[model samples]
Target: MRIFAFVGVFASVVSLIGCATGLTRAGSMIRESTDLSVRNRCEFIGTIDESERMGAGQGDNRRGALNRVRNRVAELGGDTFLIVSLDTDNSGAYVQAEVYGCGTVGSSASHAPATPAPSGREGSMTTGSGFYVSRSGHVLTNAHVVEQCREVRIPPTGTAEIVARDDASDLALLKNDIANQPIPAIFRGGRGVQPGAGVVVIGFPLQGIISSGPSVTTGIISSLAGPSNDRRLFQMTAPIHPGSSGGPVLDDAGNVVGVATAKLDPFVVARETGDIPQNISFAVSAGIARAFLDAEGVRYEILPSDPALPTENIATRARQFTLRIECRE
Candidate 1:
């Protein structure tokens, strides 16, 4: 055969250049192991290196690194959350970091890192995306990511004292022990999921850095309901931003149902009209996330065989733990 087809196309182009040089060093070691695992799950929030004599009446350098990150989050011991920055406001000097307190901070002899506040320099951290609806560890984010966090750290994983927060449905409900573990997610059951179906959305957006990972987006259900005096709300063409406000939307069988909050772009104004109405994105109904987990009593369990027939009365070990968690997702 023509010289064995030119040596089988030169050994398949040298085995595709040795698998593209081992996938370019396995994609730079998976982006430096996801940037050192999100800088070991952030929580530093403090550093302004003596803002020119301890922030002399703050008014520059990003207001003295936001007043030395509001005075070391009031002397490092009570923070719901913090993230001040000033990189170069004419270099008046700045860097204030602090992320400690929620319900999880590591180090049973391994994940130390909780002292480098910078000027002794170390600055760089991030770990703020959330999920896990309720199994006991609770969790549901976006009260501006722990809002006035009086103390909320989850470093290396573990921390959540916050108990209840609604903030007009911006939602929040922390508490941690990570209970039985394996808290990925699986809620759905809001019933009859209409409008075109198919969807999926997971987050970690921006928190994992430069829009890190866990991001997956697909769309449909561009409006099964909304503004009919708010039929619990729903609308999705999928593109969301601002770290995709409180994640979770899934449905192509993954469950979840909805949670992403808002989006609405449309402010066009071009004379003889050629382009007008555009924009819409809201979501919050999986039956208002079962009325936000039945107003926080949160129990969850209704997927015995679920095809859409769910009202909740289920029992029998909660329908065999919701049919073994919908057959392992």
Candidate 2:
């Protein structure tokens, strides 16, 4: 009888240790996949699901569900899993993810440097907001800001060379020659963003006439889809002005969740629907932005997820990379 009791206690201890180790490995592997090259190494495996238990709070349940998904991916010999979708029902939270085998790293594609801008200007100055994405001084902003401009200026960095632009997504990439650089914005991958997440926007509003420094606005993600249920865009409650275009819509952890693009025109909408929309702004989702950057062969960094920081700290960190984009058109 004593031998049997000892065997049972030992089995329980071993099981507990195994569970702890699995959780730790899952977290480490997830962080490792944040590297673009590392991510490229992985090939999609299969989709997996994890459901939360009943009687648990929403937040706790969601976390538990995610942990289980990660654990399962690891068990299937996958290094990482990209979140496809998440849903909740009366029973509990459910997570669906695509598994990948990230064993070998892949090489990143390269592109030619941006051409130098000519030393001539002949247009009115229009200012917008942008942020650095790479150590090579690649800046991201709205394509419309520089589409018709003869010269583009990024303060402290002087003139910038337009490298790439996607009119459909309203994203443009610029290169600068400044030696001193700011903190580049980090992006969250896949379906990292969800509705109701806290968000903040930093930009030069009112065409930068209101303040010499960038302004900050705080709100939460109103919806995962945009106007007319557009999947590429997301809606947020953050107030964005004309000059706020091309700015970074950051999460509480200082990760770039989206790019502040446009706000609903109250006049136009009211004329059509006989009603005004308040704080209905739109941002290009970070996942879509990441795809554009990859297609352009732009090197950028990603973070799996960072611990939540104070709003003030997040804004301060963002300002490092955020710059005022002046277009001479």
Candidate 3:
């Protein structure tokens, strides 16, 4: 039995070694470039992805992954390639490369790359935040977040479907077939949402720009009304950014009172008022949001309790339902 097991393990390693770098003589001649100038000179052939656990190292088998990709590019008759993305971990690695067929410009020394941007030249990929609204994986976010998105994703659970949206209210509901029953956010009606009440906002702000997850910001309700005295919205002092939209604003009792929607553009405001506004933000009141869900006939959870808890405890509970909302335009 032991001998058979050893033989099986050896065969697997051999197979991995052989698959890691299926380098052809032509593949050896392939060049890698992240320069936009070079990319412009070459025709965009296609994007290729290679995923496998071909090696093990602190570098995460990057060399082996590159060789395999080079082999694929050569096979596709592409002489140059630009890495679009490279993600790896202890289990395996995944690489996305854009193959380009360049003539002679790629050989020029002047086109040598100075640095690599996070990924290859691609379309805009914006990130925001959203929270589960039901056990069946219903999510809530700003309509503008996924407005023009060609594709919408909520990581781990994969792609999500936009169920219902009300542009006027700026709220959109998304549905995902999550593997596990999600712990939805507890919506506290906006009736008792008074100014000076402590609130916690959780979201993924500046997502791809900053390598981080859900962030927590604490503040007090500045006013019962929003810009132009919009009754449907509430004003708050919590700081938020471009990617903070759609995040849940929870009260001290850990019940969601609103959805973080917009932040005052300081630069634009500074130009007009000669003073930049500080922490000026707005959110769709939970009452308005809940009404929308009710109209859509989506079942959600709401608790009547207002048990005061530690801010950290509230954040931890919020994290369970909050997730990064990714949009590829």
Candidate 4:
């Protein structure tokens, strides 16, 4: 029997360049809408995570996977999806594998269309996850999505194109050939989120053909200003998976407070040898994101404006790698 459920979502937004258009305004337009749900937009792409030895036949497994996808789709209000490719080798008792894929969704319908897959090209080569952020063709995604690529394809309409990406921050900026489209996402604001607040993590985890669409999980803010080596990051207790990188982390009020970046406990060198890491996750704070945009000269303003955030803190801007690597010895 197949069952369907809704996946919940967190909130966030990002961008580059000091432009008059395609910028995300922080924390104002995030009212929960009835239209944003899995029943309306989420779709599946291909298979990335299936097990033949799990005692379930292909049909049973496929239905099980789709049900998972359906649940996630309802959570993030995402319409676009992707399949991540993995490099694996059979090891008799089990298969060893590494994850590689992208998935994305928008809070709004103004997302640009994806480019068509070329005939005979390996489907795995395509970038998968991304979300809409601006009305003028700007989309936000991990810089790794378009990394080393001459171009990338957007969703729903097969719109292929080139983009200006910033690799240092693992963030990319896409200039959609599509015109005047609004990108919907949780808004950012001057009032930063506090620790222990409720949060939802949204993304596509483990590429599976039957298991496609947005996924959501709930937890609380573990820390408001967690350390990312020398950089500051927001930490959370929400369980996350491989496909969730570069997605949104939302507050209970449905406002975007951070961008999903990394799972804290997945870095174990021996993940299978009793080295299971607790599923802690981290995100780039909205303040840091705002500073990044400011350095790039992007023209976004925070909504419901914050009077407590230091003007210097809000005004400071810089460009740097967003990933923080900390090894506990």
Quote the positional error of residue 315 for candidate 3 in Å. 0.5
Q: Give the TM-score of candidate 3.
A: 0.63
* C-alpha positional error of residue 181 in candidate 1 after TM-score superposition, expressed in Å: 15
Tell me the tens digit of each residue's lDDT in model 3 across 1-329.
00111111111111110011111122224666646675677788999998768675524365577678989988998878887777667877678999987642222222422222123434445566899999988999877677656678888788888887776767888898977899999988435778999999998875434547888999999998776577888889988765678999999989989988876555434433479678788888898899988987878988764678999999999999998887655
lDDT of 4 by residue, 91-182 (tens): 21121221211133222222322322244332222323444444445555555445434335544434544344444445555555565444
How do the residues 214-306 of candidate 1 rate in per-residue lDDT, one tens digit apiece? 455667887776543356657777765444556666666566676665554232111113454343566666666667667778766444225
> How do the residues 1-329 of candidate 2 rate in per-residue lDDT, one tens digit apiece?
00011111111001010001111122234421223343365576788988887635654566678778878987877756666666656677788888877542111111111122233322245567889998889898877667666778887669999988776667788888787765689997545778899999998776313567889999999999865566777889998876677889998888999988777755434433579779878888898788878887878998865688899998888888998887765
Best-performing candidate as measured by lDDT: 3
Report the lDDT of model 3 for residue 100: 85
lDDT against the true structure, per candidate, is 0.44, 0.68, 0.71, 0.42
Among these predictions, the greatest TM-score belongs to 3
**What stretches of model 3 exceed 4 Å from their correct place?**
1-122, 189-191
The TM-score measured for candidate 1 stands at: 0.25
Give the runs in model 1 whose Cα sits over 4 Å from its true position. Answer: 1-132, 143-148, 151-173, 176-185, 188-195, 198-220, 223-255, 268-279, 282-305, 310-329
Total backbone collisions for each predicted model:
29, 1, 0, 34
TM-score of each: 0.25, 0.62, 0.63, 0.50
The positional error of residue 126 in candidate 4, measured at the CA in angstroms, is 4.9
